[model samples]
Target: MITAVVGMAMAASGCSAPGPDPGGATATSPEPGKSISNAGETASWELLNAAEITPESTVLRLGVTRIECASGITGTVLEPEIQCDGEQIVIRTSVETPEPGDYSCPGNNMVPITVHLQSPVGQRQLFDAACLDAETLATAFCVDGGVRWRP
Candidate 1:
């Protein structure tokens, strides 16, 4: 009985499993001038092509793109900037609130916002924006489709 218990424990522990292969294949970086697309729930944008101009920024060639903001979300892009820190690139911009009472919400709140983009690999990549709510003072970048904020 003891031997049987020990055998069962060993089997459960996967003692006979093979370790990961050190010589396994690795992913290659994306080539320049490749087209990519990024879409969100309410809008989609396309990049005609991409070229990594700097370690901190990748210049995305603009193509025919359309953006549609959902109701209750009101703002205008004043200036958009791409900031890269290490392997991550965040697209941030200053937004100007619409004229007073233009949006259903009260008060004019102009906050600089950022959207995190997936590390540009090649010509093909994607980025997503989390939904926003004004009443709770929630920023974009929702977690699991729920309202969330980070200090």
Candidate 2:
């Protein structure tokens, strides 16, 4: 009787499904530093900094914050120009604008930036972050993933 009860308990516990894949919680790109294939499409994003920000630039800093993937998605920031040294994605900005007519600014200062990134799809669902205005039209999210937007 005791052996039968133990076997039944073990079976019941084993029948439960696996909780979740922590890896899938965040959206990341391919391992080789190239476009990632997901949801039947290739995905990538451009990191525009404040120093490089021009009058026509649409991107602006949203304050420094660490973002985590909520669930059911994963992605990465595909920044080829900036080098990711060690575990850091370094962003450099100078007080002086990179070019003339960049913006009407008094102080051009250098700022270092690092991002805790997931795929666009992961970020969209995790945070209320998204591209504002007409940029939305060009962005897309996987139906299964949260909300991946291109900014």
Candidate 3:
């Protein structure tokens, strides 16, 4: 849940679904601080929360608040970038936006992004890189684990 503060006022609502790919989405486990594959240049979004569909499943539905910046443009969620930092599986979100121009985006709401991982998560800890920043980690509305989640 988010409260009004500053210039940001967010609405919460969403659904989880597989990516547009028919064969199912694929993810990469790049080293920390390295860029994982994504579309165009993107911005990072912190996870409001996350849940493993099943204990053995590698798929995750990452809770996020989407900021819709244009009326005609859709699919604001870019593919998620995955990373492995020691004993943790770092999940990062890349937000896609159209080129700057006259636009109207009246809604900012929550969306659960579904991602597919190559390996079963098992016991690995989950972390959100966007929330891991030293400056924001403490103040960021991250999960109870302080940017990390345990199943």
Candidate 4:
């Protein structure tokens, strides 16, 4: 199958919490499977599956509150990191919130984040690093299709 069915609904209701830290850790770069936010409470976010993929890029659409009670879902401190390990492409995403605003309690307005690649993805598998995170994986945003491509 070439299409990945993304969870279209943003979780909210009894799941709204304060943003972890609009500002994340000062570590220059993020690791492969962790959301290193301000050294406070350990907050993690579930990554949306690839909504669109091309030879040169992968696109994800998610709300600011991503999942249940999940906050600080998007900022821009760091761009979504993309890595190709010969066999699979691993993508790691972090929460870098926007200027404080009312994006809605359960910020459910889907926005897009695109990750570009250096080379066209030929056969390398596509994986959402969020799946590697236990806390993030528990969030509803990630379901089946951890691997975006299947033969």
Candidate 5:
């Protein structure tokens, strides 16, 4: 009786956000690009290179790439495939554009891939492999903020 009651209470007390549901629907990643909102004009802009901004500087930008793979046999598991060189990685970026103003990076239209980092175990990760696996390269792109899986 007490066990049953406790079980019911425990189940009721648990309130947690659900994980990604693979069978249900796959959430698509956002596209990379510049979003400009000035006056009544809303324009979508692409990332610019640092050299483009010789005397003019615009937005704050960052890029990150992460590698992910499918794990287990569930067919829904995406795991990090260890590359011959190392772990899987993806490059992404983040640009700082002030609201109500036009912003762009200085130097060139395309941001350089300078800083590279890896992800932790049991989580998504990224690496700097001179050449990525065929599967990874298929969905890689340099978008608004950084490189991401767009395949």
Candidate 6:
């Protein structure tokens, strides 16, 4: 009887031993400045700042927040000129305006314009416009054929 009881206790204790880890060693977090990669993953871009456009110039602030490219590249900020291959963004330094006598609208009547940004994921509008007027200051940014606007 004693031997049987001892055997049962040993069996019960063995059942309580730790099992295999579900996450495994690969689940551990990477060290600082290091990264992990998996196959067939895609990269993503993140806009850091709202785009700002003026009568004389247009500006966009953007950065890459996630990357899973074939080249093993990481997320980064793209140069202003190289953004989206120039297809999605357009900037003009000088704007042509009508002559003083061409329109009755006052020069001080500056209309605020808001631009929208489009991407593979979704659409987002630029920063809120200071002012907006449809006739003269109507400008928009169409990316990937999508429109972006907050309100």
Q: What is the clash tally of candidate 2?
A: 14
Question: Model 6: per-residue lDDT, tens digit, 1-151?
Answer: 0000001111221211122222342222112222222222222222333343332222233332212111222322222111121112211111122233432322121112222222221121222111111211232221222222221
lDDT by residue for model 2 over 3-53, one digit each (tens)?
000011111222112222233443332132232112221222223243543
Worst 10 residues of 1 by lDDT: 1-10
Task: Write candidate 3's Cα lDDT for 33-86 as tens digits.
Answer: 344454543333443334433336555556554333555343455555555533
Q: Ten consecutive residues with minimal summed lDDT in candidate 6?
A: 1-10
What lDDT would each prediction earn against the true structure?
0.26, 0.23, 0.46, 0.40, 0.23, 0.22
For 71-134, candidate 1 gives per-residue lDDT tens digits of 3343443333332222222222233433444234343322222222233222222222212222
Clash pairs detected, candidate 3: none
List the lowest-lDDT window of 10 residues for candidate 3: 6-15
lDDT of 5 at 2: 8
- Please list all clashing residue pairs in model 1, or write none if there are none: 30-122
Least lDDT summed over 10 consecutive residues: which range in candidate 5?
Answer: 1-10
Best by lDDT: 3
- Model 5 spans > 4 angstroms off: 1-87, 102-108, 118-151
RMSD of each: 19.9, 21.9, 11.8, 13.8, 20.6, 27.8
| Model 4 per-residue lDDT tens digits across residues 1-151 | 1122232111121111121212342212224355422222222233354445444443343222233232424333234445444345555445444455455445333334433343445445656666565665665655653454532
- Alpha carbon lDDT of residue 87, candidate 6? 15
Which scores greater on lDDT, model 1 or model 5?
A: 1
lDDT for model 5 comes to 0.23
Counted clashes in each candidate structure: 1, 14, 0, 5, 38, 2
Better of 5 and 6 by lDDT: 5
